[model samples]
Target: MIKSLSVDETDTNNIEADVIVLGRSLPGVVVAHRLRQKFGDTMDIKLLDLSGVVDNYSSRNVTFQVPLGEDDRQRESLDAADVYIGNVAHRYIMHYMTEFNIPIPETLFRTEVSDPPQKMYQYRDGRVVTSPNDYHEFSFLNFFQRLELNNYQSSLDRRMSELFRGRREDDADSRTLRYYDRTSMESDLVSFLLLSESRDVMRLVVRTVCGASAHSVSLLFYLHQCYRNGGSRNYVGGANTSLREKLLGYCRKRLTRKLQQSVEDITFLVKPIKTIRTYSDEQVIVETTKGDYNYVCNQLAMAVRPEELSKISFEERLLSNLWEAVESARGLRPRQTKKFQVKYAEKFWRQRGFSGEILSVRGPILWAIEKPVYSTTGSLEKYSTLVGFLEADDEDEANSREAVLAQLVELFGAQAASPTEYRETEVEGFVPRCEDYVALRSLARTSSALVVWGALDLFADGDLAAALEAGHSAYVRLVLSMRPQAQDFDDLSAMQWRRVLPDTSFVTWFNTLSYNDGFRYVMYCGALYLGYRVFRKYIIRS
Candidate 1:
């Protein structure tokens, strides 16, 4: 029951909805997915998007695929690595998979990149931090494990818990939050992580995850994001596009599944939403980019970042706080990110006795991992892929792949200088990456009918799990606000909305975070940029 906009449907102004959700982000999909399960065909839900589900991150590197025999469709399934954002192990995705009875593949980690515990390095100020055994190296995980920076880790966890927990907090948590909110992540790192080595490591993690350099981000705000994704341990997004693709595949199936009947009850509008205005009867009108359609609905849930929201117009102007939120979100935008994959003759790093994961303070590329090859057959795949994230500011810079290869020389020696085959893909930063997060916090005005909801950053930061919580929360708020008085839906039990698999177990409990510290790893995010320059440039020039 999916319909595309047709000529007859253009500018109809008759499109109706019990619920209208904007943005095709993971949160929006989850929100609609939840509604489909709860109300089934009974409730009319319309989801509109200016982009694809999960936004830019989904399509950036997906253009090409690995080859096998003669078929390009012979996809290679890679082992889990840290490519996804937040909790790869306990994916909220499991909910849809289980509900649909989709089989879950056991995660196989091909950690051995070489025999002698593969070598890893930290390049800073023309120096390398490594073991006396030239080949002995560590993943970002192992480097911190050796340092044991427990105190700093504990402090960060405490700050996050005080700020981002969903339930009501005591005065101590409130005071803790106020004290930390005033400082930036760089300031806190300098004060808490004493060793220059520790700071160097800490800098990378802060930059990559937070999207800007540590100095630019508020410590309070960053911690709130960490908390939303279920504390520090949950940050794992595995290789390729497995996680997102799976989620989307299942969601689409659920959307198209027949319940009651209509020719194409679920409509997926591919174009961007141009303007959103309100009319006399609390009706929200959504105009599409091509003017091919107009959607009229009573409620709106913007499951997008704050900046994305400003793209649309509202009947009444946004108040200062609301406007300020959008501006602040613009400041937190993700930096231009590029990931590269190189095919090697064999698992060279594993032979050297190391897991091919590298986190750097200085990089043409920040993080590197030995991602497993996508193999259709259950046979030993000899061809290996080395995937890494690079700091590409613009088209010219991103196209200069040679700069990254030079860095690899320093990391793995001359043998690493060249791969049998090398290719790189750039991922555009999500335009609304952190927009909804900023707006929700700064919003001071409220409307009875037209509203936006979802996890911009629930508890101050948003990620996959928080996205689910945000979607569910938005649904709850909609039901509450749309039907203020006791209504037919009031009697609906909360049990119906419960996900088949709740993420509570994998999420680190607030009361439980102990402040143990360790070595730092990950990134040193570059300056913020609107999109991946190389992709746009290539498209334009082509």
Candidate 2:
């Protein structure tokens, strides 16, 4: 996926495209595919990809498929992978697969035997407790403690569901979303949950799910992510099959060859553009670094990060509040996370009657799931692996085989001491949270001819679901620009409506101020007022 193409400047003249999609990541591909499906031979869409830049934030590469013969029950395991598909993602993906006659992966089609087919356990107090639900298994928690946990979880779920209960276009829901976006997940948890234990538990869940601390993530973003993925229940409901892998696998297996033969071209490796010159909304002139190539296109879809977009110079017409947001986003550091897999000779945890799915509040390791190795004959292998995330930022520490294995030994037993092979992958350059949701709202309100959405954008919610959703939004924006009379736009087509931001507003902060916060503010204000009164009455008169 990281290869450069060196072409002569004169060859740029051959690049005649009606639409040019920048960044060939999952979102970019989906946008192009959707466009091609609608326009057919009428439009010439070209994919322009930059090496090592696109898909750096994606978790898709974390997990992959290793086929077990020609059977449907294909052995898809983790290099270090995490995929969460909620109702929204599942519905759209299923529709897309059905339309294209692509085979649905077995992971998505599995039947639910119980309340939850997969059981998740949390590592706590030198023992493991069932997570989110299954109260009977929570032996570590007292009756009262369990009650508090259950209450906190229920409230969280209700709030997540209520975020978009009505319609995306509804004024009430919009306001609610804005209010949530104007607040941090940390703030919400601290205010809503009474106990610090409850707060810590919630924060741990947020970190595991979103790969960022609760304080750094907006409440709206977290809720929307959970809601979109089906709900908070399904969001933290253990590991699911990799949707991104499935989609990409289908494209590589079925569509790549066929697409190459069509009018649309998947230009995998292209040099970075020097400038994007637009005379009108319908006319786009893209110049390469050498200025030897001029790719003339009618429209442009930028599925790149803000930093990437900052590289290319564009005319004033293409600039808006979104451009300003992009300027602000370029300087923001993305959320970072690391993935590791510990290969062991035996399933030691399973021997102790544990499911091997472990979550921790304190960690170098935050969340882990058992990944049993499978032979080509579709039988289980003696060796098994524990795949999960590392909370460490330092490269040496994250990649440290001993540090990870030591933690495993503490959690499991002495049996976890010897690992056959240890592997680690560091993932960075994720979508960072904006300073406030008002910024996102302002950006969303501003419409532009150029459709832009990125997997690494500040406004992005930092998940494959968001990328997929935003891709369709980009396509809708492009389509609406071309055909204003088009009535087929989905309810989720508006990108502005979905792009969430952090709650950093002073006004919002004051409005949702807690009893403790209100008391402190009142005390500080009282002290200041008293000092001012004394100075004015005595010092000024003298």
lDDT of 1 at 449: 54
lDDT of 1 by residue, 1-542 (tens): 44465556645546778787776555565566666665777778876655544221232223233321322333334333332323322344444444544333322222332343433556576455543222212233344433434445655665555454434433335445555655677887786656676676667666556435676666766666555445543332222223223221222232223111221245365566677777775677877767856777887777665456556555553222355554554444444555677776767666665566665667766666665433456444434666766655534344646777787777766777768888766444432222233343433123345775443432112123344445555666666676545334533332132112222533444323322321221121222232466667889999
**Distance (Å) between predicted and true CA of 171, model 2?**
3.1
TM-score of each: 0.67, 0.73
Worst 10 residues of 1 by lDDT: 518-527
Q: Which ten residues in a row have the lowest lDDT in candidate 2?
A: 77-86
lDDT tens readout by residue for model 2, 1-542: 33344445345455677788887655676678777877777877777776545332233433332332442344333221122333665555444444554554433323222444234444445455554343223434666555555655555656654455444433445666667777888887787666665666677767766667888888877766666655565544334432222222332333222332232344546777778877656677777787655777777777666667668887766664366665655555555566777777777776665656666666777766665433334343334777776676524443557767777787677888888888776545353363554455344334356544433233232244455565666677677777666536452333333323333456334434444554578899999999999989998789
Q: Pick the candidate with the highest lDDT.
A: 2
The candidate scoring highest on TM-score is: 2
Residue 362 deviation, candidate 1, in Å? 3.1
